[model samples]
Each structure stands twice: as structure tokens, then as C-alpha cells.
Target: MEMLSTISGWIWNPLAYVALGIGVLFTLLTKGVQFRRFPDMIRHLRSGGATEGGLSSLQTLALSLSSRIGVGSIAGVATAVAAGGPGALVWMVITALLGSTCAYAESVLAQVYKRREHGEDRGGMPYYIKYGLKAPWLATIVAVATLIGYGFVFPGVQANNIASSAELAFGVDGQVVGVLIAVVLGVVVLGGTRRIVKVVEAIVPFLAVGYILSALVIIGMNITKVPDAVVLIVSSATGKDQVFGGIVGYAVAWGVRRAVFASATGLGEGTFVAAAATTTHPGKQGIIQAFSIYIDILLICTASGLLLVVTGAYNVKDPAGGFLVEHVPGAVAGPNFMQEAIDSSLPGWGAVFVAIAVAMFAFTSMVFFFYVAQTNLVFLLGERRSKVLEAVVKAGAPAIAFIGSSVTADAMWAAGDIGYGILGWLNMACVLLLTPVVRKVIRDYDRQRREGLDPHFDPGPLGIKGAEYWETQKEPVKEPDRV
Candidate 1:
């Protein structure tokens, strides 16, 4: 545990600045596409229909959101407030705003380089890194790292959160919850990508709407406290709050760290799912993905942060192993803070509500994790899919989830951070190298849109090499379906 924390500190400290810098760079290069293309994002999101080989834009978004809106939004936000104060939530918002650009760039690149595999669209960081940059060796390394991260290290974090929350809310044993999660996840994962897609699309919308509406109700009940909560967030973020001024640095660090974890912006997880969408133009999917960053960090995470601040259901721990503030005395940081916050207003309800939310959030994330790992494993195996290796992933993913549930939260989180840190560094490097290509693609997309025509991708005309899928697409692009 001590060693893992040390490594996590080393990896994440510099990564925060790097992620912020890359996001700023992408924003400038694209002339703030995330802002300029806001309307297009919504239009594209409600427009696309699923093809035989690809998911609809909305379905793809649901898949990515399944991963993005996980325990990170709830437990992660609580942890940020408990350790970094209200200021941390402020930085989280900032990170998401800037990071959305990174999300756009990477998703565009992913769509541009996607491949037709086993009768479906398949690609991500590995595909883009190899084909776009012409670096197969580096792509291979990334594939391995992705397999390890998603298959082994990350699932544990999600499962652990689910188990912990269930234990708190229902007084069920953690081990029992863990086993049930593993069993259910195994059933979904074994059914393959289409099954995962249907399940995620069904669950994500209901859970997200339910959780956000619940938060709104809680905030409405405590309407008088909203202004003070806002004030505390701003003051602490700017080092002006008397109680939290000393830990302002920690606030910035923790906020960025947790935001990256929550949004999965530069980690390249979205790229894998984004590549699977059926869209006429890659930029359409890219724009939709940038919008998802706002949904994950700005809306859901903010709900959790507000619940903590408005109800004073959190604690702040100094880096020096002492208490900065302890509103919930002896309460450790996690979903319990949010649970307690809800209970303060409606007795005996917080635990059950939060527990169900955590279970759903974490379970969906596990499903996405399995997909990503399987995608990378397919990449590693080349044209011949290995049934034996596939079986291993199908079995190992659930087994890891169960094992992770039994581990301590601190250890699971540290391991998850290490996985994220490694993937972030690799994916960012690839995205940076391919910036010129991303720029050209965005311009092509914008030109078509400005001419009042639905945009379509033709890599040959744009001088984009290695987009074999688009190069082979000789037919006219189909108009997207309206919602």
C-alpha cells in the first residue's frame, strides 16, 4: 500500500499539469471546437442510427457514459471533498471544461482510424497509434498496458466501491455482494459486445436520470443552503476560505486527479467506444463525446459535491494526518458521506439510495471495462481471434472484480490510479503526435457543416493515410436518423 501510494503520487502529480496543458493546447488548435460546436454536439447526438456493424450515436454515448459515470462521481467526489475541501470540486469543473477538448481530439482520431473487425467496428488508442502514427511497436505496448489496466487493475476499484456501499447500506456482508456482482458481470460479459451494448443502453439512462433527480430534490429541500455552498466552493478553491486556506494546493491536486479519474478524458477509454458509433463524420462522434464530459463531470459529479457541502456530510483531512474539518465525526471518506448527506434530510433513506446508486454505477463500469479489455486483447491477437485467450478474459474479468471487492478501498484506488496514469501518458503522447491530422479532419468536418450539408468523411481527399475503412467506403454517406 505504501509503495503504491508513493508511485501514484509520483505519476499523478506531474500528470495533472500535463493533462491541463494538453487540453489547453487541443482547445487552441481546434479553435475551441468544444465551445464552437456545442449545438452540433446535441444535433449529432440525437441524429445517428445504428447500422448493422456499428452502434447509433446515442448508444455509443451510453456505452462511454457507463464507464464515465461510475463510482468516481459519487465516492470519488466525496473523497475529493474530504481530502481537498470544497475547493477540489471547483478544480474538477475546470478540468472537465478543458479536458473536453482532449476528449474531442482523441475521439476524432479514433473514428478516423477505426477498423472493421469480426463484422463490427473496432479500434481505439492502439489502432490510432499504429495506423495514424505508423508505430506498431508502441501500439503493441499500449495494447498490453490497456489489457492489464482494464482487465485486472481497474475492475477491482469498481467492485470494491459497490461492495463497500452495499455493506454500509444494507448490512450485507461485503463478500456476498462481491460474488453477486461477479456473477452478474460474468453473465453480461460472456454474452459479448452486442449484449453489453443493450444492457448498458437500458441501465445508463434510467440510473443517471434517477441519481441526478434525486440530488436535485435534496438540493431543493435545502434551498436556503445553496448560496452558502457555492460561496464555500469558490472561496476554498481560491484559498480565501479561512478554514481551508492552508490546503488549497491539495485542493488543486486532488481535484484534477479525481476529475481525470471520473471523466476518463485523456485515458483514451472513450476512444474505444467512440470508434464503434455509426456516423457520417468522425467529428460528429467527437462532438458528442465532448458533450459527455460535461454530463459526467459537470452535472453528476457536481451533484455529489453539492450534496456533501450543503448537508455538511463530509470531512477534510490534512496531509499531515490530522483533521482539517470533521462534520461527520469518525466517518471515513467514500459513499458514506453522500449517504449521510441524504439521510440528514430523510432519515434511513440515504444508505439505501446511495447503495443502489453505487451498485448500478459500479456494475455498468465493470461491463465497459470488460469490453475495453476484450477490444485490446483482440488487437493483440491480430486477425485470428484466440478462443482460449478470449475465454481467459471472459473468466478473469469477473474473478478480478470479486477479488477486488475483498481488497481495501485505498489499495484498489491506488492500483486503479497507476493503471490510469500509465494509460494517460501513452494516449496523450499518441494524440499529440497526430494533432495535425486531427486539425485537418476537424476543418473538413466544419466546412461541410457550414455549407448546410451533412458532413461525410473521405480520407483520400483530406490526405489522411491509413484510414482503410473510410478509403474503402465508396458509397454515399447515409443521413443520420432523427430522434
Candidate 2:
């Protein structure tokens, strides 16, 4: 346990700084792409509905959101508050605000450099890391690292959380919950990206809305406390809180970590999602993905944070130890934190509702994590449409799930934290090198939009137009008609 904690600390501590720096840099370099494109993005994603062989922009966003809006939103908040203090919630909002821009840039770069393979369009950090940065070796390193993170460590953590929570809430055995989760995950993963997208599209909306409404009801029940909670968040964020005991720094780091974990900005994993889109223009898909960060971080995570703070469930001391803790016997710390908060105000069924919500939230994330691992594997092994790949993924999912349930939650979190830290450094390094290319793509898209031209026009081979990196790596000019 000590070793895992040390390992996780080593990974998370340094990478947090790097993630923050890269996030700030990209937010500045891109002229707030997240802010400018947010409204346009919302409309674009909604403009088309899902179609066969392809996800509509909204479906794509929903799928990505499903992966993000899980334990990270609930448990992550609890963890952050526990580690840092109530002030952490304030930092989370700031982190999400900045990190969402990074998400925009990376998603755009992924779209710009995306390629088609096996009758499907695919693109992500691997593409940009290899082709855009001309660093194939580094790209390969990141790909392998990411696969291990997703395939091995990440699922175990997800499973453990689910099992622990289920054991508490339902009196079901932990192993039973683990096996059930594994089976469900196996079914979703075997169905491939298209199937995953379909499932996410169906579930994400209902689940997210349900979670938010429940949270709002809790907040309304505690309506008188809302003003004080808001004041606490704002004051603590700015270091003006009366009970200042490292609260400012604690809040900032806590908030940032939760936002990063929830939205996955700079993680480079979400790009696989864009790779599966059916859009002619990768830019369109990228734009849609960028918007997902906002939905996940700004909306979902913030809602969870507010619920905890407003309800006074942000317990300062408990074994779970955070603003997101409660006194429920069978409740997992985070949801119980919120549950207890609600229960205090509403009584009786509050914990039950929160328990159900947490189960669904955690379950959705488990499926999403599997999809990330599957994509990384496909990238490394060369996309062979056979049962071999499917078999490996299927087997791995359940195995990881079983391991997850058996392990301690803290140990699982520590392991996941380590993986996420390595991923952040690798991903941010790539983003820094590719920022210019991302900028160029955005400029070109904006120009085309202004001039009433198709935004999907290939800008390469004509001196690689906007991006300096692409300018130097230009392929030989082909006949204009030879797309």
C-alpha cells in the first residue's frame, strides 16, 4: 500500500504541473478555441443525428462524455476534496476551464492528422505524435504506454470501485458485482466502437440528466445553504477563506486533478473516439470532441462538486476523508458523501438514490475505459479484423474486472493515478510540439468558413499552407484531381 501510494504520488505530483503548464500554454496559443467554438460546436453536434456506419457529432460527443462523466465526476471529487480540502472544488472549476481548451486543441490536431484504415477513418495522438511531430518512436512509446494503462491498470481500478460500492449498497458480494460488471463490459467491448457509440448515445443523455436533476433537487432542498456554499468556494479559491489552512492550494490542486481526470484533457486517449467518426472532415469531428470536455468538466463535474458543498456532505474528517464523505455504512465514500448530504436535508431515500446513480456512473466509465484500451491495441497490432483481437479484448476485460474487485480501492486509485500521470506527460509533450499545427488547422477552418468554402479541403501538398511543421514534412505534389 505504501509503495503504491508513493508510486502514485510520484506520478501525479509532477505531471500535475506539466498538465497545468501545457493547458495554460495551449489555451493561450489557440486564442481560447474552447470559448470561441463552444456555441458553434453545440450547434454542429446537434445538427445531425446518428446514422448507420457512423456516429452523429452528438453521438460521438455523447460517447466520449460517457467515458468521462463517471467515477471521475463523483469519486474523483470526493478524492480531491479528501486530499486537498473543500477548496479543491474551486480549483477543479478553474482546471476544467483551462483544460477544456487543451482538449479542443488536441482533438483538432487529431482530426487534422487522422487517417483512414479498414473502411473506417482513424486518427488520434498516435497519428499526430508520429506524423505531425515526425517522432514515430515517441509516438510508439506513448501508444504502448497508453495500452498498458487502459488494458491493465485502469480496468482494475474501475472494477474495484464498482465492486466496493455494490457491496456496500446492495449487500451483494463484492466478487458477484465484479463478475457482473465484467460480463457487461465484455458484451459492450466485443460489439466494437459502433456498438459502444450506440450504447453510450442511448444511456449518456438519460443518465446525465438524471444525475443532474437529482443533484439539483438536493441543492434546492438545501437552498438556504447555497449562498454560503457559493461564498465559500469563491473565497477559498482566492485564498480569502476564514478557515485558511493550506485551503487555497489544496482547493486548486484538487479541482484541477478532478477536472483533468474527468475531462481527460491532454490524455490523448479520446482521439481514438474521433478516429471512429464517419465525417468527411476530421476538423468537424475534432470540433465536436473539444466541446465534450466542457460538458464533462464544466457541467457534470461542477454539478457534483456543488452538490457536495451545498449539502455540507463535504465532510472534513471520515475514513474516506473529504468534502465528499458521508456517514452511511454501505455507501462508497464519494456518492455517500453526496448521499449523506442529501440525506441530511431529505432523509430516508437520499442515500439509495445516490447509490444507484453512482453504480450507473461507474459502470459507464468502465465500458469507456475498455474502448480506449481496445483502440490502443488495434493501433499497435495493426488493425486486423479477426476474432484474435476481439478474443484478447474480451478476455482482458473480465480479468481486469475481477482483479479490480479484489483489490483495495486506495491501491487501485494509486495505480490509476500513476498511469494517468505518465500519460499526461507523454500527451502534453506531443501537444506542445503540435500546437502550431493545431493553430494552422483552426485558422484554415475559420478562413474557409468566412469565405464560404468547404472546411474539409485538404490543405497539405500546397506548401502545407498554415502549419509550419506540416510545411517541412510536405509530401510530393499530386495532380489536383488525385485526392
Best by lDDT: 1
Candidate 1 lDDT over residue span 99-154, tens digit each: 99999999999999999998889989999999999999999999999998898879
Candidate 1's TM-score:
0.98
Tell me how far the alpha carbon of residue 108 in candidate 1 is from the true structure, in angstroms, after superposition. 0.3
Against the true structure, candidate 2 reaches a TM-score of 0.89
Q: Count the backbone clashes (under 3 Å) in each candidate.
A: 0, 7
What lDDT is obtained when candidate 1 is compared to the true structure?
A: 0.92
lDDT score at residue 138, model 1, on the 0-100 scale: 96
Residue 343, candidate 1: how far off, in angstroms? Answer: 0.9
Q: Which residues of candidate 1, in runs, are more than 4 Å off?
A: 479-483
How large is the C-alpha RMSD of every model relative to the true structure? 1.1, 4.6
lDDT of 2 by residue, 24-81 (tens): 8877876777777676786566455443444567666777887788788887887776
lDDT of candidates 1 onward, in order: 0.92, 0.70
